[model samples]
Target: MNTRVVEIRNPATGAVTGTCQGPTPAGSCPYAGRDGVVPCAGRLVGPAEGDPRCWPVWVPPGCRQCRITFNDQAVACLRAAERYRDQWDAGLHRERERVRALAARKDPRFRGMSDRQLQVTALWRWRLSGPAQGLRHAEQKQRDWGRMYLALAEQQRAATPPVVVGGAA
Candidate 1:
């Protein structure tokens, strides 16, 4: 999306903590986005009541459509400055490390790219490219399947003899 979203996770377990963890209480991230927080990936735990991922024990946390889209001005800010890390002062070495780590979390492919490489070739563009590429692949696959189904239907029709009632008497 055009904005950044932080999936709030349990610090101890790394499992998504969900939006319900927040205030009106004494403790919460001071940086809650203007857009708000995403709900925990797990809420209702079954197909009869809600989601299938919550079932069969060993329940894996999967994304649901009901995510709270917290506005990501902070992430956008970091993304703007990240590609220029190679030129940042030596004092920013720790910041550079932090930013690279964050980028990798977004996509593992980012790990191979140096800051200069990111800037020169526009890593953000590449990051955006991945999802579009997947969409293109899906569209191509669907088209192939549709045509195959059509051909099969046509062949079946051709093989069937026409039903003639009392017309030739």
Candidate 2:
């Protein structure tokens, strides 16, 4: 396919910023047009969901009909979930260590601390449960995405038949 060049201009002042050549010229770095192509008015330019740069491309009518593009939002969500899971796991580990340390203390006074101290110590031991639960929830969501990915892959495979390499036996 021939790559078409499009001129990107500043909307406010109408000054040309750069030129891009592609089917859908979006998110490309701005460069001065050497071919002297005029900029088209009302061309769409913006990052799709998760992209950082403002891609200069137009979305065809009905976004649902467009091919599946790598969504940054979905990736960001997954990363956030992973961070939450990691944070929860760390908290759980720290809580376990604290419990162990408290259990190993030799001082009798420390062992027979006041009710408030005992409650505070027990609170840390119990606090880990919340993070563990949060991690489970995050992991479940990750698994759900994995299942969805697999299902989509299976559907795609089913839609496309394998080509036979040799004559039928």
Highest TM-score: give the candidate number: 2
In model 1, which regions exceed 4 Å deviation? 1-128, 167-169
RMSD of each: 23.3, 13.9
lDDT of 2 at 47: 26
Local distance difference test values of all predictions, in order: 0.37, 0.46
Mind giving the per-residue lDDT tens digits that candidate 2 earns over 65-134?
A: 1112223234545676677777776776676556556656754634756656755675566555766676
**Where does candidate 1 have its weakest 10-residue lDDT segment?**
50-59
Q: Write the per-residue lDDT of candidate 1 for residues 1-169, one digit (tens) a residue.
A: 2122333443234344342322222323333454443233333211222222222111124532322211122233344344333333232444445556666687565667777754534433433555544544554554555555445434433433332333232
> Which portions of model 2 miss their true places by more than 4 Å?
1-63, 66-84, 106-128, 161-169
Cα-based TM-score, every candidate: 0.25, 0.38
lDDT against true structure, model 1? 0.37
